[model samples]
Target: RKMKGMENLYTLHQEMGNILLSHVLIVRENSKLEKAMTQINDLEVRFKDVQCLDTSHWSNPAPSMIQQLHCQIQLAKIITQGALVRNEFRGAHYKPEFDLNQPKDFDPHEHVDFLEKQHYGEVQENEFPPGHLAYMKRFEECNKRWLNTTIAEYKNHRPEISFEAVNTSLVQPRPRKYD
Candidate 1:
């Protein structure tokens, strides 16, 4: 109870282990992802039992730790889902199922409608910034297909992802080449 301290939370984090590291992570097949996600998801369910032990809101660290853990779970899900959906091998996003030189991942005008419809950028200037879109922000190759941006809305404990348009009316996107 109150004497539990943060050992339980620390143990939970340790349980996640290396699955939390997204960078330099290489997984060829979906089954690997399936297993990792299953563990993380199961961790989420088990997290409910995580003994905060210290419920003292004043100068208490348990609440913050729990909040961070919750956010981590959500982010893990986002990364997994994005990796699952994208069928191409563009930039750092790689799926062994697709060729190294596959087609571009995004459509330049993909999210224009969603952006305009939502009248975005009105959120707290701090949290999401008025001009920034929200829910989830992903970093993919910025090519013509990605002229705007993509968004993911986590609704009803699930993520409903969509794209938002970028105001590229002034300048045009050209072929991006490093050679």
Candidate 2:
């Protein structure tokens, strides 16, 4: 049963990754990166609720787990924000000023060029500030660990039967008699 759960977790993790990538592409394609940023900010605000534990288990999910997940989401938002900031022009994120579908003078290419010029003569040690790099690395490491754990659990628990497809089939199957 535990192994089945882990397998389910793995499948879920893969599906989620694909969905996230699609979202990123859509945002970039539509030049709605700023909109996504705003939404993420709103989510961050809502995340405050996770911190407030109700101590009730029957109605509420595990507070500690919820809090940890919330933290992971926040970390992802932070990393995304950093990437957006680093890539001045809209890269994976959309900016109203630059439309990705159409050719714009200020594209990601231009932004990369600018960044390259800005760091051309900088020493390797000074490329990224120590404090900022440390924080980013820490967030990245934690997020990776969270994702790995989630995938492991999903793979272990997912149902083998295609529940949705089976439910929608033209021929209804007889209900099973449980022992």
Candidate 3:
């Protein structure tokens, strides 16, 4: 089972992956995300070259790779679109423009006790950095509004985005700290 354009499809997939890495990385912004989406779309269009002459999965794995490529492209689109809609920084999806700066002297290890107390209602407001209270207020608001499971479905050659309420009944969501 030989495919005529397996090599071309492999190249396109490689290019798509590189584009995704360079643009939709850990730190993201509007323009780069859009660029990544555009490039991914371009690569998807190029996927037409993948002439699956042999559809059978007997012996040859080219068909399997092509199927995987299709899935990878769709997933990339979903991730890019999801990141674009999310305006606030949460977890690894950080957007520098919409985030606050940490205190210059802040060290997570040094403030472990304080950070623990903040979650337990033992820390005072005055103990926080000057502008941290405002940032935290904004973060809490964002959490209340945007904290949901992003469900993406691929249809009509594009991804349809939806959200579902996250189940937090058993264990409550706690504030996360990376710094």
Using lDDT as the measure, which candidate wins? 3
Candidate 1 weakest ten by summed lDDT = 131-140
lDDT string, candidate 2, 1-179, tens digits: 01111122223334334434644552343333455455555554544443333455477654555545555555445444433443222223334443222222212233333335446853243445344333333333433332121111122312121111123235322111112
RMSD of candidate 3 to the truth, in angstroms, is 4.4
lDDT per residue for candidate 1 within 1-179, as digits (tens), equals 34343248767777776665532155445666666677778877877777786776689887788889888878777766655555544444456665433124433343343344436654342544232333112222334344434566788875565667777568643322223
Model 3 steric clash pairs: none
Per-residue error at 115 for model 2, in Å?
21
lDDT of 3: 0.75
> Please, what is the TM-score per model?
0.56, 0.30, 0.75
Per TM-score, the best of the predicted structures is: 3
lDDT of 3 by residue, 1-179 (tens): 34566447667778988998899989999999999999988888778667665556578776778889988988999999988888776766878887755545554443554546767978676877676655555655666767788888878889888888778667545446664
How much is the lDDT of residue 88 in candidate 3?
A: 70
**Residue ranges of candidate 2 with Cα displaced over 4 Å:** 1-22, 25-30, 50-61, 88-179
List the global CA lDDT of all models.
0.56, 0.37, 0.75
